[model samples]
Target: MKIAVASGKGGAGKTSIAASLVLAKRGVLAMDLDVEEPNLGILLGCSPGELRPVHQPVAYVEPDLCSGCGRCAQACAYGAIAWFGSGLPVVNESLCHGCGVCPLVCPTGAMREREKVIGEIRSGFVDGAPFLEGRLEVGGVSTVRLIEATIQAGESLHADDWIMDAPPGASCPVSAVLREADAAILVVEPTPFGLSDVAGVLEVVADMKKPAGIVANKTGMGDLSLDDLCRRFSVEVFARYPFTRSAAKAGARGVCPYRSEETWVWKTESLWRAIERRFS
Candidate 1:
């Protein structure tokens, strides 16, 4: 089963949940699609060398090829191609989606498709579970392309279970990662802000018609009103993690709190079993 773990905002323990699931379930391939700020490798104690670079094709304008017509620029829907008054069109490497249409529209063959190393895809073994992740270069805006690369890397493995950990927020990056997931686990805190953001995520999932569930993290410290919100939205509250200082410290040390047989860990284990039962 392909499961995606996501959150409405950052610092909601999404990666922690995803990593614990990978460790608990055997033969699982963990993919970290949070390319912007991937911390899954750090939390799992996986080394950087195990990961490799993943590249994507972007347009390269060959100035010598000819007439500075704006057909290439007009054909590009992503605004990746910009035409300077009379010069050959300049390709904005960052904005290009490498859709290959620009080259087709170039009358003079001035635009060519070339592979660019925009990001890296890394994979390592964590407690016998295969962990794969992608990282986009800083200041890079082609997160969607890198995410596609990450998905391709994980799909090539053909593991029994594919656990995808998406970046925070319900935007293009999150949508790209969650597109093909069999199930989605939306992790949220019990606070008001968490409830509001999760509602947005649920709307997106609902529109996609993807099955989903909620995991309330840091449950004991807040009002726990998220339960009402879930019920109102007809979403299941699959699990809860109580607020604990030791758990916090372990996370700060880049460790999975689920490593111990404690309250939150046991709860997370049960949550995984529930997810498997619902989607397996």
Candidate 2:
């Protein structure tokens, strides 16, 4: 089962929880879908292996075979093909969604698909467990596409357990990861800021119709009641973990605290059992 660990805001310990889940379940496929800032691999204590470029078909015209029929321009509803009075259309590569419609309507077969590198996927291992991550190229626009590719690459490994570290916030990238997940583990701090942010994330998770439970982080601190929010959303309280100086320092050094912290390991195991109950 692929479980997504996400939050509406940053610094809510989502990635830590995901990493902990990986420790609890050995030989799992751990994926970091946060293409822009992929740090879970760091926390996993593994560097990504050789990078594999992910390509998508972008429409380009072959000038030699061009008829300038204008059908290619007409087929593009995204205005990716900019038409000049009587000359061949210029393709705005950034604006192209790679729909390949231009090729379908080209009369002279001038339109062709060229593979453009949108991002890179890396397959690696953390403590003998499969670890996968995706990193979008600089100035890339296909965020969700890359995220989908990362998830698909992880699935290709065919692991029985999967832990997905999702990017924070309720953006398309987050949706892309959470929508396909078997369940979601939402981590929220008890601060006012975290509470406000988590409210929006809960709506997104609910809309997806995915079973979710809240992991209350920094349980002893903050005034905002995460329990109230969980009750409001009718979500189960998966785990409530207290703050510890060791956990914070270990995380700062790119170490997986769950590996050494017995309390953390137990909490994560309990969290896993609670979440798995929902699946059954």
Candidate 3:
């Protein structure tokens, strides 16, 4: 079963919940799909091994072969190609989606399609569970491509269970990770910001028609109640983690706080059981 843990906003303990879930359910492949800022390895206490470059098809223009025609620029719907007065069309690597339209529309055969290394996939093991993560190269714009590569890396492993720690926010990267998930675990806090962002994330999940539950983190921070929110949304409250100093310290030390009996380990364990019951 594939379970995705995501949040609409950052710093809501989404990664914490995901790491705990993987620890509770051994043999589950944990995937960190936040290519922009991957923190799962820090919590998992494992360094990424065997880094492999991930490439995506992008358009490359040969300046010498160009006729200065604006056909390539006109054909690019994404505005990836721009003609500079009389010079050949310049390709904006960041704006290009690699749709192959520019090369197809180039009249002088100046445009060619080639692969560029935008990011890389790093795989390793953490506590007997396979962990894979994607690291997008600096200034690289192909997050969705890197996300697909990360998912593909884990899919190749074929583990007993798969838990994906998706990137925050309801964008392409988040959608890519949640697209194939059997279920979703939305982690949020009790504050207004958390509640609002969680609602947005729930909307995305509802659109995807994926079974979902909520894990409310930092339970003591706000007066807001999740019961009413869950009832209104018809989503279950899967788990709750309170604000604790030890938990924070453990997290800072790159350790799973769920391993400590003083923390909300039991609650997270029950959450994992509920997920297994639902997915199994």
Candidate 4:
């Protein structure tokens, strides 16, 4: 069973909850699909391993074989190719979506597709448990592709239980990971801003028809309640963590909040079991 720990916005305690769930049991495969800003490994105290490059196809022009037909530029829907109508067309690597349309429209075969390194996957271990994380390269635009690659790599591990730390928001990157999960745990603060953020994600979860529960983090810090939103989505609240000075201090010091306090550990374990009983 795969459980995806996600949030609609950043700084909502998603990674902390994800780490707690992974620590709930031994040998549970933990994957960080937040390629742009992956911090699950740091929280898990994971030891770094081999770095595997993740590739994506991007359009490139060969000046030697050039025919300035401008057809390649015209055919590119994303305007990745720029033609002066006299010389070789300049292919912008960043704008290229790798749709393979540019190469097809090239009459002189000057346009070609080349693999570009968009991100790297790091495989490691957290207390002997397998951990995989995807880190997107700077100026990378293929976040969805990287996320998909990360999920594929994790699937190869063949672990019975898995916890995926997904990126924030209901965007394509988050959907890419959540689409493969068996269930999801949405961590949210009990505040007005937090409510709005989670509402967007809830719509996505509802649209995907995925079973999801809520974990209200920093409950005492906010006066607003998530009960109405939960009722609207028919998502039950599985756990709650009150705001505490120690918890905040521990997180700032790169410590797992659940492990820092005894009560928090019990709360996390109970939440895990409840999730297992419902989804497994």
Candidate 5:
């Protein structure tokens, strides 16, 4: 089973809770699918061992090929191929979805696929448990593709269970990760903004028909509550973490407070049990 720990927005202690969940359970593979801002390694204090580049096929037009039928340009669903009615059609690498349609549509076989480095996947261990992470190259437009690659790489571990720290929000990247997960743990702050943000995520979870529970973080820092939102979504609040100076300090230092605080460890364990009961 893969449990995805995600949020509607960033900085709601999602990564912190994910790291704690890994620590609370044994034999669970830890995977960080947040390619854009991957910091689960920092929080877990695990440095990656091998960095392997992830490549994707991008359409390349060969100028030497005779026919400029413009069919490749017109056949592109993503508008990645631009034909100026001149020498050669321009293939926008960023806009290309790597669908390989251009080559199929090309009458002259001018279009071909070339591998492009979109991101890198790294493997490591956190306390003897396998950990995997993906980091997208700067200016790379393949967020969902990289996430898919990361998930594929994680299968090498072949662990009994997995916990993924997904990117915040209900974007394609998050959806890709959630599609591979058995359930989701939505971490949210008890604030108006948090409630509003998580509402979108709940809708996505509901649409995907995935079981999800809310982990309210920074409780007492906000006046608003998640009661109405949870009731509307029919998602239970599995756990709540209080706002404390020490937790804040430990997080700032790239340490999960659950490692030091007894209360935090108990709370995390309780959360894990609740999840197990609901999904087991």
Candidate 6:
């Protein structure tokens, strides 16, 4: 059973809950799909893993073999290529999405793809569970593709119980990670702002028609009436974590509260079992 834990906004304890569940059990594969900022490994007390660059095709022009037919420029949907009715087309690397269409439309075979490392996928272990995380290049905007590639690598291992730590919000990257999820856990704080964030993610999950549950993290901090909201949507709020000083302190130091204390550890164990009972 593949489960994804996500939120509509960042800092909603999404990663904390995801890390807890993955560590609560032995050999449960944990994948961090937040390519822009993956901290699951750090929270799980592990070093950087085996790294493989996520390569993308970048268009390069072969001036000698160029016919300046402008076919390559016309085929580029991203407008990465520009031709002025003479000479080889100029390629804008920053605008390129690496679709490889320019090369396919090149009649003289003048356009070809050069592999560029835009990001990397790392594989390591957190306890006995396999850990995979994707990191995008600084200033790189190609998160969806990197998330897709990272998940594909994880799927190749054929793990039965996988927990995906997805990016926040209902954007393309989050959708990419949740596409293959068997179940989704939308973690949110008990606040009006938190509900707004949850609403955004709920829309996407609902449209996908995936079985989903809610988690009210940092409970007692606010009275957001999450129960009524869940009831209206006919979704269950399965877990709630009370705000605690220890959790705050541990999080400040890049540590998970469940890993640092036994009480939180047990709480996480029970929470995962509840999730399995309902979704598995």
Better of 1 and 6 by TM-score: 1
- Best-matching candidate per lDDT: 5
Give a tens-digit lDDT track for model 1, residues 195-237. 8888888888888888899988887877557757777667888
Candidate 4 local distance difference test against the native: 0.89
Q: Write the per-residue lDDT of candidate 6 for residues 91-181, one digit (tens) a residue.
A: 9886788987888888888898897888999998887668999999998777888998998999898888998999999998999988989
Candidate with maximal TM-score: 4
Which ten residues in a row are the worst by lDDT in model 4?
Answer: 41-50
Each prediction's whole-model lDDT (CA): 0.84, 0.86, 0.86, 0.89, 0.90, 0.88
Where's the lowest-lDDT run of ten residues in candidate 6? 223-232
Residue 71's lDDT within candidate 4 is 93
Question: Could you tell me which residue pairs clash in candidate 2?
Answer: none
Q: How well is each residue in 160-234 modelled by candidate 4, as lDDT tens digits?
A: 999999999988888888899989999999988899999998898999999999999998899597779989999
Which should have the higher lDDT, number 1 or number 6? 6
The 10 consecutive residues of candidate 1 with the worst lDDT sum are 260-269
lDDT of 6 at 127: 75
All-Cα superposition RMSD per candidate: 2.1, 3.0, 1.8, 1.6, 1.7, 2.4
Task: For residues 157-254, write the lDDT of model 3, one tens digit per residue.
Answer: 88868889999998878999889798999999899898888888888888999999998888887658887778767898877788787888887787
Tens-digit per-residue lDDT, 56-165, candidate 2: 87888899999777888877988889887567888988777798788888888889989899989998898898899999888777778899898888767888888899
Off by over 4 Å in 3: none
Sorted on TM-score, best first, the list reads 4, 5, 3, 1, 6, 2
Error of 5 at 273 (Å): 1.6
Alpha-carbon TM-score of each model against the true structure: 0.90, 0.84, 0.93, 0.94, 0.93, 0.89
Kindly give the stretch of ten consecutive residues in candidate 5 with the minimal lDDT sum. Answer: 222-231
Local error of candidate 5 at residue 149 (angstroms): 2.0
